[model samples]
Target chain A: MTFFYISAAVALISSVLAISRSNAVHALLYAIVSLLSVALIFFMLGAPFAAALEVVIYAGAIMVLFVFVIMMISSGPGSTQQERRWMNFRLWIGPSVLSAVLIIELFAVISPPREPMSAKPVIESKQVGIALMGPYMLGVELSSLLLTAGLVGAYHLGKRKDDAAQTEDVTIHD
Target chain B: MTSVPAEYGLILAALLFAIGLAGVLARRNIIFILLSIEIMLNAAGLAFISAGSKWGQADGQVMFIFILVMAAAEVSVGLAIVLQLFHRIRTVNSDEANTMRG
Candidate 1:
């Protein structure tokens, strides 16, 4: 229970930090921490398979892609300093106020039940697979198709138009 | 083992979702915007898992797997578009993408 509270705090603080950063890479690092903490929360909730997937997919694979893009687009040190200079204190007021309101709303609404914890069966990965394959098979197939389409679309959109050939032989400047 | 209340997990998930919303509404960089969307997706996944726990079922985890696949597809397509935008305009700021503006 204490571990759950600790991870939840970590997730909240890190997510706050992530959204507030001006540097994309810095924000991404904090987002990874936030995801890992959420994975811990999943573990505490007795969903170990979900926890592992959260860590592997969110914190690991997706974040690496983000880092790759950030590096690909970064201008240089001059841009780093420019990003820091662009971080005006006034810009944070909106998000901070919104977050505060949400925090207050959550605390006001959630009243824990007095009943003590009861023994629950551990959910194994095998059970998750069985359930997925049984009742949710359509969802699984659709997801695979969606992933394939996304891959093809990404490839098509990302290809450079100029790579093939120039339409005109030379530019005609009047 | 001292088990925590389900409300605690729900509260945390709600807070995370709110933070993600704030990020989406406030952040100007497209990458940050996409990242905020990912945060929100994860928050939803958390809620589902917590709800499943409350009911003592694996349905929540199953839903999370679907969410995971959808998120992956979204990121791939989104980053591809981001890459294309960068190549076209040389900027990643969302506000600068006004070519379609009338």
Candidate 2:
């Protein structure tokens, strides 16, 4: 119970910090921490498989993609001072107050007495696989199709018309 | 198992959702807005998982798997658009991209 609370609190705090950071890379780092802790929360909640997927997919793969884009788009190392100047301490106040209201609301929600459920059967990966393959097969296939389409679209959109010219220019400069 | 209540999970999910909302409403960066949307989607998934746990069903996890895939697709498309927008206007700030304005 304490561990669950700790993980949830950590997830909330890091997520707040993640969104508030002026530097995109710094925000991504904190977002990774937030996702990792959310995975821990999932594990504690009895969905170990989901937790693992959360860590592997959300924290690992997706965040890596975000970092790659951040690196590609950043103008280089010369903007550190400018980024530092933009990181205002006062920017924390809005998120802090909103999160505090949420924490208060959480306490209110949890305080209400309700009928406790009978213990739930642990959901393992095998069961998830069966469920996915059985009733949700169509969704699974569609999601794969969506991913493929997204990949092609992203590739096409991200390709620069001047890519060859830019490379040649760089080589000449070198 | 420590036998945590489903309501606790719901409360946590709500908190997360609210935080994500705050981020989306407050941040001007397109990437941050997208990240905030991801957080909101995760919150919804958490709520589904919590409800599934409460009812002792696998449907919630199944739904979450779909949500995960959708989020991945959304991010790829969104970032691609972001990249193109940056190439065009040389900025990722959402407010600066007003070419579509009437």
* TM-score of chain A, all candidates: 0.69, 0.69
Model 1: DockQ vs. true structure: 0.46
Candidate 2: Cα lDDT at A23:
75
Q: How many residue pairs clash in each candidate?
A: 0, 0
lDDT of 1 by residue, A13-63 (tens): 889989999878668867887887788778668788998899898889999
CA lDDT of each prediction against the hidden true structure:
0.80, 0.77
Give the poorly placed runs of model 1, Cα more than 4 Å off: A75-118, A163-174
Model 2 lDDT per residue over B1-102, tens place: 256688988998898889889999999999999888888888888888888788777888888888888888889888989987777667899998775524
What's model 1's lDDT at A134?
95
Backbone steric clashes in candidate 1, count: 0
Q: How displaced is residue A20 in candidate 2, in Å? A: 1.4
Clashing pairs in 1: none
* DockQ for the candidates, in order: 0.46, 0.36
